[model samples]
Target: MDKQEQALGLLQAAVESMGGQVRPGQQEMVKHVVEALDEERHLLVQAGTGTGKSMGYLIPALAYAQTSPKPVIVSTATLALQSQIVGRDVPRLLESLKGKLSRPMDVSLLKGRSNYLCQYKLGGGYPDEDEGALFSMDEKPPASGTVYSPLANEVMKLREWAEHTETGDRDELVPGVSDKAWRQVSVSAMECLGSQKCPMADECFSEMARARASEADVVITNHALLAVSAFEGLNVLPDFDVAIIDEAHELQDRVTSSVAGALSARMVLTAAGGAKRHCAVNVDELTKAAHRLEKSLTGIPTGLMDKGLPEEMGIALNDIVEQSRLVLALTKPEANAPADGGRQTARSQLQAIMDDAIRMLETEERREVLYTTRPREFVDGRGYVESDPGTPATLNVAPLSVAGKLREGLFDGRTVVLTSATLAIGAQFDSVAGSLGLMGAGAPSWEGVDVGSPFDYPKQGILYVAKHLPKPGRQLSAETLDEIEELITASGGGALVLFTSKRSAEEAAEILRPRLDAEILCQGEGSMKSLVEQFAADRDSCLFGTMTLWQGVDVPGDSCRLVIIDKIPFPRPDDPISKARTEDIARHGGNGFMQVSATHAAIRLAQGAGRLIRSVNDKGVVAVLDSRMATARYGTFLKGSLPPMWPTVDKKTILGVLKRLKP
Candidate 1:
C-alpha cells in the first residue's frame, strides 16, 4: 500500500484496538490534516463535539513528527486538556503507533513559570517582598502589616515538595493547593524573574519544561501561555512543524484577553512601593499618581451603570495615564542598581497598564452599547461617582489583527493546525479565520475540515425556546424568571441556568431558590471547581452562573439534565473595547453587531449546548429563554449553529423528556 493507504489502515486498526469505531468522515479529516502539514499549509479543522478529534489530529501530527525535522506543537485551551494530551492521550497513541511510524516520538507539557513551584520561595528567598508572605506561613494567618512576611514558612514547604514531586505540575499536588497558596509558588508573567537572573535558574521547573519541549515530538500548553509566547515573542514552544489548536473556538477571546492589560490604583501603588526600594526619587510622585487616578476615576460610578463609556471618561483616563508615566519614569532606578530587578518589573507593569490606557484614549470609538453591572458604587453623592462598593471599573479590548503578530512574532513560518469543536459559525470558516488574521496576505494555504460529533444531537436532545415570552428587555424580564422557575421545577434541579450578566444570574437564582427543591449553587459563592463539584456530587443540584460558566463548565450524564440560557450573549453597551471594535468593524463597512456580537454569542451558546450531552448516551434539554430565537431575523442563524437537535417550542414536550431521564 502507498503512504496514504498505510496510514489510513493504521488509524483504522488503532481505533478498533481501542474499542472505537472509525467513520469515513473522521478518516478523511485525519488524512487532510496530515496532507496539509506535508504541503506546509495552515489547516482550520472544525471537528464537531464527538469526532474523536484528539486522535484524529494526533495520529497525523505524530506521523509527520517522526519523519519531519521539526517537532509539532499541540496547543489547547485548558490545562485539563494539556494534561490529557501530554499525560494520557499521546502516551497511549505512542504505544499504538510504535514500530509503525518512522521512529518513537517524545511528548511533553510546557507551562509558564507560575505553573511551577518557585525555588526561592521554598528556600525562603525574600520574606519581605509583597508575595513573600505566602511562603511565610503554613496556614491562613492574620493579615500582617507587611505583605510578604507572614507566609514565608508555607512557601518553603511548597517549594521543597515541588522539587521532590515527579510531575512538578501544580495539578498533581494532592488536595490541590488554594489559589492563594499557589500564588506564592507560581509566578505571573509580569512578576517572573527571567531564567538568567532568577536565583534558582539551574533547577528551574520552567527551564526543565522547556528542555523537554525542545526534545519532544509534540508539546502541549494552555491558551494563556500560547498567547503569551506569541505576545511576548518568546521561543518557549518546541520547534513545531505545525500546531493543532484544540478548542479553536476560544482562540479569539483567549488571545484578546491575553493581549489586553488592566490597571488598578492598588496595583500602581504596589509597583510604586516596590520601586521605592531601589530609586532615590521621591515616593511622593507614586502617591500622587494613585490619588490623581482615584480623583479622575471618582467621576464615574462603579458597578453596572447604564451609561456608556463616555469620551470625557476616556479623556480622564488619559490624564491618569499621563500622571502614571510621570511617576514611573521618576521612580525608575539606575540601570546598574542592585534593586534594578524590582524596578524593571515595576516599569514593565506600568508600561502594560499604560498601553491599555492609551488604547482607550486614542481610539475614536463611540459607546453605543452599555452593560449594566452591580459593581460597588463608590460615590460622594454626585449620582454615580467611580468609588462604589463592589463595583470595579474594567475595560475590554480585542486586537484587530493578530495574524501578522503571530506569523512575524510568534509562528514565523512554523506549521500550525488550528482545531476546535465550534470553530465554524453557521458553516463559515472565514468568520473565525478572519478574526485570527488567518486571512492575512501571503498566509499559508491551509486545509479545513469538520470531524462530526459522536452524539446524535437530533435524537438525544431537544432545543426548546420560550417563543411565547416577551422579547427579553435590558433588565431580567419577569417572564424570563417565571420560565426559569418552571424549568428548574420540571427538571428537578438537574440543570445549569446561564445568564448574560452576573446580576441576572443572581436574580434568577434568588427567584428560583425558594421554589426549587434542590441545592442552588451560584458562581460567586465559591470557586468554579467547588461549585461544579457540589453540583456533580448532588444529582439534583442546579448551577446558576454567567459568561465563563457558559463554556468552561463540564458535567456529563443525568447530573445535568437541562441547560437553560437566559438570553443571547451580546456585547454590553459602554464597554470601551467592544465599542471601539464595533466601530472599527463598521468603518470597514461590515455588520459590527452580526460580526462581533452575534458570532460571539453563537459560539458560546454552542459550547453551552455541547456541555449537556458529553457522551453518546447522554440526553438532555437545551432551553433558550429568549423568544428572539424565533422572532429575530438572526435567530435562525444562531439556532443553526447549535447541535442538530430535535428542536421544539413546546414546554410540555421538554418536561416529558426530563421526566423520562429522571432517576
Candidate 2:
C-alpha cells in the first residue's frame, strides 16, 4: 500500500481500538499531512474540535517515523496538549500499529530543562572546585511560621519523589508540587551546570530525557522550546524531517517572547550586590552604575519609546556595561583558584544583564519595538499585575513582527504542517497566512486547508449580537450586565461569561450573585480545574472569567448552553508592540488597524465564541453584548471568524429561545 493508504488504515484501526469512529476531517488532515511531508510543502490545517485532529496528525507522524531517516517533531502550545500527545495519543496509536509498521516506534516528551529536577541541587551536592559552580532553575518555598506549611510540605514531597522517579519530570508528580517548591530542585538552561561539568550529569533527568528523545522515533515538545531553537539558530530538538505544529495560532506570540529581552531596576540592583560580593576590584564604580540605572528608570512614563531611550537612560546603561566589564575582569575565574558556584552564577547573571542592556540599546533595529512598563506578575493569562508606586519601570525589547523570523528559521529547512481551530480569520486564511509569513514574496511556499468542524454550528448554536446595548467604555455598561442577568435567568444557568478584564467579571458576578437563582462560580476563586469541575457538575451554575476562559476549556453538553462576551478582546489601544506595528504599517500606507488590531480581535473573538458548541450535541447561544460587534464595519469580519451560528439582533427572540432552555 502507498504511505497515504497505510496511514489511513492505521488511523482506522487505531480509532477502532479505542472504540471511536474517525471523522472525515481527520482523514483529510492525515492525507494532507502525508502529502505535505512527501512534496515538501508547508501546510496550515484548521481542524475543529471533535475532529480527532490529534490522532489525525499522530497517525502520519508515526507512519513517517517508521521509515524516515529522521524523526518527526510534534509541537504543541500548552503543557496540557503536550501531555495529551505524549501520554495518550501516541501510546494508543502505537498499540494499534503494533507489528503493522516497518519497525517498532517509540516517542519521548521533551520539555525545557527547568521542568525537570536537578539532583545536584536537591541533594546540595557539587562537583569538586574545578567545575560545577552554581546553577539551579527557579523558586523558593514561602517562609513558614505555623506548625504546617503547604509549600514546605510540597517541597518535602518532591524530595521524596526524587528518589524513585526515573524521568524526574515535574509533571509526573500527581497533584503536583508548587512552582515555589520545584524551584528548589530544578535547573534552568542558563543556570544549569552542563552534563560534562556537573557530577550528577550521568544521572541528570534532563540529559537522560534528551538522550532518549534524540533516539526516539517521534518527539513531542512545546512552541516556546521550538522558538528558542529557531531564533537562536541551534539544535534544541533532535533533527527532524517534519514538524507538525498543533495550536499553530500561538506560534508567533511565543516566538516574539522568546526573542524578547527586558532590563529592570531590580535586576540592576541584584547584579550590583552580587558583583560587589565577588569583585576583587573597588566595587564602588559598579555599585554607582547600578544606582544610576535604578535612578534613570525611575518615573519614566510607561509607553513606547518612539524616538528610543532618553539620553540619561542611554548613558546609565552604557555606564553599567563598561563598569560591569571592569568588575568582571577582576572577578574572572583564576586557573588555579577553587570554583565558587555563587561567583560563577553571579558572573553569568551579570553578563546576561549586560547582554540585555546592549540589546535594548539597539534602537536602529526597525523590526523591533522598545518600551518602558511596570513589571507584571503573569498568571493564567489573567491577573497580569503587580503595580505599585515603588515598582520601578522596565525597558522591554521585542520583535515588531515574528513573521520573517519564523519563515527563515522555522519553516525553511523542515517540512512543516501547522494546525489550529482558529487559524483562518474571517473565513479566509489570507490574514493568518500573511501574519505567519507565508503570503509575501520570497516567503516559503505554503497552502491552507480548513477541514472544518464536525459540529453543525448553525443548528447547534446561535450568535446573538446585542445591537441595542450601550457602547462599552472602560467598564461594562449597565445595559450589558442587565442582558447577562436576563440571559442567565432565562437559561436558568450554565453560562460562561468571558470579560476583557477581571474587574468586569467580578462586578457582574457580584451584582448578579444575589439576584440569580442559580449558582455563580468565578475564576481565581480556587483552582481553575476545581471551579470548572463545580461548573460542569451543576448544570445551573455559571462561570465568569477573562482571557484564560476564552479558549482551552471544554465544558460540553447542557452544562454550557450559554456563552457571553462583554466585549471584543482586542489588543489594548495603548499596547506598545501593537501600536508600533500599526504605525509601521501605516507608514507604508497599509490598513494598520485592520491588519493588526482587528485581526487580533478576530482570532481572540473566534476562540471565545468557540467555547460554545464544543460537541455536536452541545447547543448554546453565544451572546456578544458589545454593540461594536454588530455596528462596526469590522463586525462582519469578526463574525466570519466564528462558527456559522444562526445570528440575531432580536433581543426578545433570543430571550424567548433561552427561556425554553430552562429546566
Candidate 3:
C-alpha cells in the first residue's frame, strides 16, 4: 500500500482499539496533513473537539517521519495537552503500529531548561550569597521548635526524589512543589552554564533530554520552546523538516511572549546583590540607580508608552547601564573560574537588562510597543505585603506583531500543519491566517479546511442570549445575576460561569453563593486542577472563574451541562498591546476594530461557549448574559464563530432546555 493508505489503516486501527469509531472529519484531516507534508506546503486545519485531532495528525506525521531523513516535531500550547499527547496518544498509537513501521519510531518529550533540576544548584552550589536570601531556610517556630516550614519540607522532598527520578522533570514530582520552591533548584536558559562547563555535565537532565530528542524519530515540545528555537536561534530541539502545531490559535501570543524583553527594578536589585557577593562592585550606587529608575517609572501612568521615554527616565536608564557595565567589567567569568556560575548568571541578567533598557530608550521601531505596568501584588495587595511604599514597575518592550518573524524563521524551509478547534473566526480562516503571517502578499500559498466537530451540536446544545436584559456595562447587573441564578437552578448546578474579569467573577460568586442551594467554587480558592476535580466529583456544583477557565478548561459530560458567559470577552480599553495593534491595523488601511479587537473577542467567545458540549452524548445550554450578542450589529459575526448550536433569546426556553438536560 502507499503511505496514505497505510496511514489511514493505522488511524482506523488506533481509533477502534480505543473503542472510538473512525470519524470522517478525522480521515479528511489525516489526508490533508499527508498532502501538506508531501508537497512541503503549509496547511491550516480547523478540527473541532472530539475529532480525535491528535491521531489525525500523528498518524500521517509518523508515516512521513519513518521515511524522512529528519525527525518530526509536534508542538502543543499547554503542558496538559503535551502530557495527553506524550503520555497517552503517542503511546497508544505506537503500540497499535508496533511492527508496521518501516523503521523504529522513537519519541521524546522535551521542555524548557527551567523545568529540569540544575545539578549544580542541587549540590548546594548557589550562584551567590543573595541567592540564599531569596530562598531562605530560616523559620520562626512555635514553642515546640519543630522547625516547620513549607519551603524547607519541599526542598527536602525534592532532594530525596532527585536521586531516584529518571528525567528529573518537575511534573513527575508528587504533590507538586510551588513555583517559589522550584526556583531554588532550577536554572533558566540564561542562567545555565553550558553542560561542558558545568561540574554536573555528565548527568545534566536538560542536556540528556536534548540528546534523546536528537536521536528520536518524533519530538514533542511546546510552542514557547518552538519559538525559542525558531526566533532566538537556540538549539533547544532537534532539527526537523516537518512540524504539527496543536492548539495553533495560541501560537502568535506565545511567540510574542517568547521574543519580548523586559526590565524591572527587582531584576536590577537582584543582579546588584549577586555582584556584591562576588565582585568588588559599588552595590550601593547600583541600588540607588535602580531605585531612581523605579521612582521615575512610578510617576508614569501604567500603560503603553506611546511617546518616547521621558527625559528623567532616560537619564536613570543611562545611569543603570553605566553601573551594569562597571560591574560586568570587574566580574569577568574567566577571572572567577570554578565558582563563576553565579557571576555568569548575574552578568547575563544585567547585560540583558541593560540591552532592553537601551532598546526601549533608543529604538524608534514602530513595530514594537513599550509599556510599564506594576506587578499584580502591588496592584491588588493579594499575595504579599509590600515593605516599600514605592513598588517598582516593570517596563516591557515587545514586538507589535510576530507575523514577520514567524514567516521568515518558521515557515521558510519547512512544512507546517497548524490545527486548532478555534482557528477560524466567523466561518473563515482569513483573520487567523493574516495574524499568523500566512496571508500577506507574496507569502507561500496554503490551504484551509474545516473538518468540523463530531458532536451533533444543534441537537445536543442550545445557545441562549438574554436579549431582554439591559446591555452589560462594566459589571454584571442585578438582572443578569437573577438570570444566572434562574439558569443554574434549572440546570441543577452543573454549571461553569466564565467572566471577563476577576472582579466580575468574585462579585457574581458572592451574590450567587448565598442565594443558590448548590455548592459554588471560585477560581482563586484553590489550584485549577483541584477545583476542577471538586467540581467534577459533585453533581450539584458550579464553578466561577475568569480568563484561564475560559479556554483551558475541558470537563465533559453532565458535570458541565451549563456554560454561562457574563459578557462578550473583549479587549479592555486600556490594554496596551491590543490598543497598539488596533491602531497599526487602521494605519495599514484595515478595520482595526474588527480585525484586531472583534476577532479576539470572537475566538474567546467561541472558546467560552465550547465548554458546554464536550462529548457526543453530552447535552447542555450556553447562555450569554450580554445583550450585545443579539442586539448589536456584530452579533451575527460573533455568533457565526461558534458551533451550530440551537439559538434562542427567550429565557423561558433556555430554562426549559436546562431542566430537561439535568439528570
Name the candidate that leads on lDDT: 3
Number of the top-ranking candidate, with TM-score as the measure: 3
Itemize residue pairs with steric clashes in candidate 3: none
Candidate 1 segments whose C-alpha is farther than 4 A from its true place: 1-3, 127-157, 280-291, 300-398, 401-404, 407-412, 440-444, 524-527, 530-541
Tens-digit lDDT track for model 1 on 563-631? 999888777665544555666689989998888788878888898888788877888899999889988
| CA RMSD (A), model 2 | 4.1
lDDT of 2 at 139: 51
Q: How many clashing pairs in candidate 2?
A: 3
Instruction: Compare candidates 2 and 3 on lDDT and give the better one.
Output: 3
Worst lDDT window (10 residues) for model 1? 366-375
TM-score of 3: 0.94
RMSD of each: 5.2, 4.1, 3.1
* Candidate 3 stretches greater than 4 Å from native: 128-148, 283-285, 377-391
Candidate 2 ranges beyond 4 A from true positions? 125-151, 278-282, 334-340, 375-391
